[model samples]
Target chain A: MTIAPDRLSPFQDEFYSALMQAHEGLTEAQSHALNARLVLMMANRIGDLDSLVDILKTARSYEHG
Target chain B: MAYDYTPFPYVSPPGLTAPEARHRVVIVGAGPIGLAMAIDLAQRGVASVVLDDNNVVSVGSRAICWAKRTLEIFDRLGVGERMLAKGVTWKIGRQFHGAEEVYSFDLLPEEGHKYPAFINLQQYYAEEYLVDRARDFPELIDLRFKNKVVAHEDRGNHVALTVETPEGTYSLQTEYLLACDGAGSATRERMGLDFTGQTFQEQFLIADIEMDESPFGPDPVPERWFWFDPPFHAGKSALLHAQPDNIYRIDLQLDVDADGKAEAAPEKVIPRIKAIVGDKPFRLDWVSVYKFRCIKLDRFVHNRVIFVGDSAHVVSPFGARGGNGGIQDIDNLGWKLVAVLAGEADERLIETYHDERSHGSAENILNSSRATNFMTPKTPIEALFRAEVLRLAHDQPFARKLLNSGRLSVPCSLEGFPLQTPGTGAVPSGRAVVDAPINGPEGDGWLLEQVQTGGFTLVGFGDVQLPEVDGIARVGINQRSADYPCFTALKGLAIRRYGEGRAYLFRPDGHVCASFTAPEADAILAARARAMGAELEPSR
Candidate 1:
């Protein structure tokens, strides 16, 4: 699911751009490794995965619907 | 008596004549954690009194790195912007073996948080900011400095404390006491809690020095610079951190015995710096020798006295996580205390604090140990392993993981918390949807943006209305454009992917409470009521 640049709010664009820049030079494997760690770290920070899953499913449905 | 014939120059306020009845909650320390608890309590309309022995905030540097999550908390308190303005943001960090740069990682990319990359401001400045904020709530909070808790007796209903003030001794009665009183917590000791952990074998020297020549390469960035190799103190590592005012805080591992007890001298540190940077003139600002230890109280709370910050847990400062972790402990406990005090939740919520925060502390200690293991290789075999890992990190993904895992500044969630339900079905990890750019209905940033509020926030993505509980606040976002105005300026990214009719409830302290599809209002309210510990029926 690719987020469209035009649809992104100002802060969104800045964050997306920065994130891309952070991963710019890394290979796919490196990026994936970093992403996996980030996923766990973020999960820990947010603390509730069941709720987050509900959020993700809702977002995905919104896109597909 | 004869001289008293003249009227007094000034009459004190009526309330001043007698010490106001002791507050319900008395925080024994006015350090950052103590002040933070006071602020949180005051915000919840809970009366609190904070007492500190020191008259002035500490002058020398202590903790340097403020994690992204902490910055978010500061933002809620309206001080994060000022901190971000004064502090340096570091996103990229490099690992060194001797003078060689081995592995580098970018911390900014994967952290969907809307705050800056990690910020570096001296611990004193952070405390000063918190103290200044506390001054605004004079009525709700009483901040007494130079007053020490000489004695405390936990009476069944209230804790009676005898404090020494400049004038004389006075007695205070408070329902609960919080010890934010550093590692040498008298309250913790008084409660007879056992602190369990191991202390490092060697001692470390920390110095704040003004370098005449920059040790950083051209296009210098503020990062954790590590030097791992011999001669500069064999089997020891040096860390250079750029602080404000052109001062750099340097940490050097020293070859000293467990009983080594020497004050950090510039002569010893300068010669070591000369070994690495080749004889550059520098001025020493402050220096201290510290022995690293990893210890945590068996329990965080005893009777009515609770421990926060260093009193509860102490970890090595290798990852710069100790003080930051300490602040987070209070942040997690603050709201729970409010809930318990306000009768919004049961005392059971307080027990989860130790369970969750101890887990976090354990993780932080683990990460710090990893960094220490790599930076200060104790054994020759370990040294060889570190060297080989660094060499492979140049091209290998696993090497990057080993190196990046050492930084360990990410916030841990409480999904697996014993008190939390595992959920009826598969839980969404929030990773796949993280990159999507969906905004809140009111144009607030996104799911990540809401996490910064520093408490439980329930985000209703659709037009669904949630039954209100006393302590919980519900925000409904229905705007098609993901530009919620409330969170437009915050530091986290917007969620770009989600189903239209979904809603999520977040726990106070920035954890997800629960999520649901379009459900009957009754079920949602019941779940919330149970989670928040509200009586099934309203009180008459």
Candidate 2:
């Protein structure tokens, strides 16, 4: 049973705003550090090393593909 | 068949020549939101003078999608059943990437709830029903048609309004002023408040065509079909919805350079309709070409005047959030205004209305703006991401989850508010009441209908005894308990929705204020006091 009709990310605007807010005051070097810490925090929350690695590889693949 | 645009009779008011006595509340605008505002206030036993610039109901099938939560609020105001009986009820929605269907969903899988997930009824019919319902309290709801508000000023504790009519002009004084006007609110314009948000330049053709043919295959039982770049209309999105009277609402995206007047013409629109629905003979019931903006006022409440519906917040129509959101605004504002008017609470209660509904409107704006942005991306990068998502959505399930087509309106959760007791249960505080079917002394009835609209209701489920509190009605739900005005859950539906051994406190607007595992007198009273915004902070 589909609980909500739109399976899409209904929160695109919400997450986009949050991302901009997170980078609002940070410099380029600080932003890199923030991104790294954010990724690690999210990975820890996910707690699945295999899926995390797969997503990490997928992110890198998007740069060239 | 086109809806008859018969204007309502506009009787000349005595105030046409002489100044009238100060009214408690004056609502400007007679659209669905404004009419419903009058009805909701009347239901709460507070009288309001509803003034509209126009006498007729809305011109077209504008704001057609009424969500389930809005239905509950409408039921409280005494017009839910009428709209339900006339509206086309649909729970199924199918999304498509080109000709292939990506996903189909059933919004409400389980039964026993009072209303359906959504209903499609023209805004005119809903407003007519609300106007008729308002007549039920003829003494309270003084609906004046063809009355226009030329200007207004908030006089510290009261507001003075200069109104113009066909006969002449008159002045009115009221304790509070309510702007239930449409998106182009005269009150909002006059106030010159900041209505900041994104405005999309792309045009959309909204046509209500009446044809005996069904769009949803054969056996069309009211369903929503959305297509992204259909074969008939390439490189543009299209939506088809069924309403009552064999009329269908079709929305097609037009490019930024599309001519508004030329597109609305029959020569241009007929081919589009014929393209969508092959040889189905149809008549154009109503047609318009428009662009929507998702904008909102910085504050809904400004001194003695308050804004509700499109006047306070406007959203793109894709998600069916516009009218439904306005209904929610009225539902939130009704009892608070009544309380403040009756001197039952401090004026501070109005501030909570601002807090809760502003949060609600912001959420609506965000969802709608995101959907608009996705549909008509201004930047090439945004368009690429959207197209990729749509393309991958054809096969990849994860990508299908990224397709945004207007998240339908649902009640906003006011979880972290100061009014709530701040605890967890099946349904936590500050969230609207979710309905369940129940069997009681009156036979079969829904849980939402059993609760009070303008007063506090304490509902205890399964073996839980409710505390006797003042101004709060008591309700107990069990399989067999009939001792203290209790209801039999019949098949334990209420128990499923609301777990056993917990008592819930519902405010007048049918939103939960607090919940307790055990009956506590002091805690319940304190929470009630906070919800009313009457008493000062109790040594917090």
Candidate 3:
């Protein structure tokens, strides 16, 4: 499965901008901390163990050795 | 238009000349709470003497938000309609993060309620209207302006008060000394009571500005607008509310170490106002800089001398809970005190006021405190969490609930209280009765108006005949002609809200004490007895 056209609907660009804006003036460590919290919150929003596992495996495919 | 601050006449009391007879009740402070307390008692055929140091209504627009539950209680006290007409009605609240809107909510989406979700009116207008309403019962409510309670001693059976008036000092006695005195209560101080809770370090500059144009801009409907890190005031919270007489209330969060005097000065305030309104012609009506505290007495009912309103508890203004919570305290205490005085119930019934309203005040404090903490984060981690929450709130539905702009006042439920008999229905036991439109033989009316009488009431919905009980009024909805007052539920909203074929028993304060699917005469009596504190007796 690939990213759907409606992945975040019309808010795709807006959401991405907001995500970047969240780390506007934070240090690298603080940015990483924010990313960690964001991932946890998004995972909580997704709220499905099997689907989260599938998504985790799918995201791992993008990582190159 | 500015409100005229007319001072009420200061008439010296009879006690000034000679020792007056022991009164039934004495309420300190003639603010909204004390005046409303006196009016509520008077309506219940219990007379009270209201004393106050000041002769005027609240100076500024202190508590601008009057919630629906408070309005219903005010309606019973005779000033609800007057306020509803004079105040700006609003239900929608919008929360913003910086320049972007995060979340919005409709407080009362559905209709059929007599009053709206919330109304914004100057506290002075409400107090003035209450004073006018309090005058309707001149024989019952003795309003003595400039009467300061210098000292009070609880004398087992009664309270002895030393009041200083413009004429001279005088001695008075009362069966119950109700300390409706506000946050800085002299009465509470005299009693040496401990008021414990959290006080925030952050100070807010609240100003009421008048302008011909709406700050909400072009074709604005009055709504509560809250912003965090708003563009005008970066990295701080601000609130805008519309009140009567073209007055708009704006609260701006100030730095923890901001000079209170400087922030409240017109020089400093004008630029802040201009920053938000942008060259819009506006006049500053009132401005004050102050921090908020969430505090309450360990016990509201302290023997013969009981506390009500701010004297009992105080909360931050975040949730509009401070004033609304005080009004709820009056609603809970007034009926119980009247019952105890009239011998309809044991004195222990008054103790339940402490049990119920203390719980209510605690709930308000908890909510308002949490919102204040979220807005004014003490730690960097807390700020991070809040910022992330606001960011997610703009998109994720689940994240919206995490936003703490102010919960807004709703009637707290007393479901598990001892006075309430557990049952199943649309309105749960021990919750405030929901208002619904109805038409009776005489004319159209609301369900709350009929049920909120000064005595216990039984509302029979569709074929559930009201049981005949002494001292309890009966009303039927959508029931065929019998004996008691019957009404057709307009649009069947009453029947829908209150389950069909169910009998709801309400206390004098309009809270559902019990509900029955199959109501029995003996069962109804037992429940009434239980509500009146007979349940506290070992014989029961």
Candidate 4:
């Protein structure tokens, strides 16, 4: 199955800069907390259940440590 | 500490001593929903005969959390101010994890709305208000107590029902039969429809404790406090809500192994109350232990027999959706039934009631079930997810938004509805009319009060000209002497909401049916017809 990317990521660079700035002086626990918060915020903005489920599956589809 | 349970005078009914003329509408059950349904019907000029097995209001402080939208609907039904005066208004909710505050949210941060985010009034008071309001329509509302519906059959055009009165049993007929008969509905049971959904294994002890002292310390503003893992109830959820007359509703999640009988006893409940309130003097006003469920019928409309309120659907109490959702259903269905009986719209208009309300009910069930799952995890993995969310909520604003301690009920938008004429603005088509303070012919009133005056309203902003449409009331905002009723938006809230030179058409139920940058006669007529569940004509 293919899901075309339709997110408003035109300001991806600025968003990324702000995201990094949000965790500038945070420890490991604080950084993880920030990321979790970011994920939750983005998920709420994208309220469609199917889209959220697909996004979750896509995120888990990759390998991470 | 207990409320004085005033029993309504139950006069014995004549049942079918002599076959009376067919009732325009017959509503079974005189609970809040049934009473509201009758009142809504009466306001739309349709009379109803209300039958109830019992002649009293709810005995307990059940369904205390009346949502803002429900209060708005209650306003239209002529009891909003009374409920507001008697109810504890609260908007902020605090969520705690293990005796530590994780997050808090304000439900209605915006202003200019008439009702608060939520009002904690006992269901008995709500029923009393509704019943009293129903009495105002003495000619329209025929309330029969101790008259129980034993059997009913939808006879295509009408429903023939068997009634059992205190005197004797008799049969009668009604044009439209509304089964407002609650969750344990005898009507639903007789229909052989399965009311099935998620029934949790975890039981909750619901108790109303009467005390003058505030558990949250001095000067306690009424607010909801939900605990994911309070110290008193480790690993379980606890909830506290303030109600009118110094009564407080406390719900503690009980283990599946917990005895229902023992948990309800004062000896056992008092200890749990002590753990939470700590030596606080309180009397047990009411106590019950039960599991919650989310369930609904496949189809609400079956010929002339229609199911309203809990007879049609039920959701977990966590979200305050049960009574609130039923009131919304009554609000949605009342007008269409009025039109159908009056021959203004086709009987198909009644189907939209099912279509739109089923959507609302399903969303309520989904949200309530999700909240229930988060509160009572059925598995270790689920519990871990909930715990992590709560922990993350302590530090992350986004996670706090994700914390769903039963997201309080709101009016469901009918977006993508067949009736809606789409547009762009704050007041979108299919959305409920947002209340704004306005200076009408009378000193002052809310937008909803004005909207409640007439049939489908065409609210025009700033000299927007509209074509003459029958059965459509025209209201000019910020414009006077325009051959229509005019209102000066006191704070310019209504004008700002609809934008300049734009017109929004609201359905009879206060939902926006269409919006027009410029009012077009043919288009407006088409939308109006479609709102009545008639298909659009090809010519238009």
Estimate the TM-score of every prediction.
Answer: 0.77, 0.91, 0.91, 0.88
DockQ values for all predictions?
0.02, 0.13, 0.07, 0.04
lDDT of 4 by residue, B1-540 (tens): 567778888775555568778888999999999999999999888899999988889889888999988998899898999999989999999999888898887999988888989999999999988999999999999999889899999987899999988788888889999999999999989989988888988899999988999876788998999999899988889999999889889999999999999889999999999999998899889999999889999999988889999999988899899999999999999999999999988888888889899999999997787777668766444555566667656655555666767878988999988767677856778898888888877878778887766489888887788777877888888885788888898788878777888888888889998888888889899888888878833221
Number of residue pairs clashing in candidate 4, backbone atoms closer than 3 angstroms, sequence gap of 3 or more or interchain: 0
Tens digit per residue, CA lDDT, model 2, B1-540: 778988999989768867788999999998888888888888778888999988999888888999999999988888899999999999988899889999777888988888999999998899889888888998998989989999999998899999999988899999999999889899998998888788889899999999987777688788888888889899889999999999999999998999999999999999999998899789998999989898988889888999999999998988888888889899888998898888888888888888899999889988888777777766544555568778656656666666667777888888888777787889988999989888877899888987755699989989777878778888888835544578888578888888988889999988899898897788889888888884545321
lDDT (10s digit) by residue, model 3, range A1-59: 23322345334333533554577677768877888998899999999998888767655
User: Model 3 over residues B281-352: C-alpha lDDT tens digits?
Assistant: 999999999998999999898889989999889999988998899999899988888888878888888889
* Candidate 2 ranges with C-alpha deviation above 4 Å: A1-65, B479-483, B534-540
lDDT of 1 by residue, B72-116 (tens): 667656677778888878877777755567667677765444566
Q: How accurate is candidate 3 locally (lDDT)?
A: 0.89
For each candidate, what is the lDDT?
0.65, 0.85, 0.89, 0.85
User: Which should have the higher DockQ, number 2 or number 3?
Assistant: 2
Docking class for candidate 1: incorrect
Report the error of model 3 at residue B524, Å: 0.9
Q: Ignoring the other chain, what TM-score does chain B have in each prediction?
A: 0.85, 0.97, 0.99, 0.97
Cα RMSD for candidates in order? 13.6, 4.6, 5.6, 8.1
Candidate 1, residue B276: Cα displacement in angstroms equals: 4.0
Candidate number with greatest DockQ: 2
TM-score of predicted structure 3: 0.91
Candidate 4 interface RMSD after superposing interface residues: 14.7
- Summed backbone clashes in each candidate are 34, 1, 0, 0
True contacts reproduced, candidate 1: 0.00
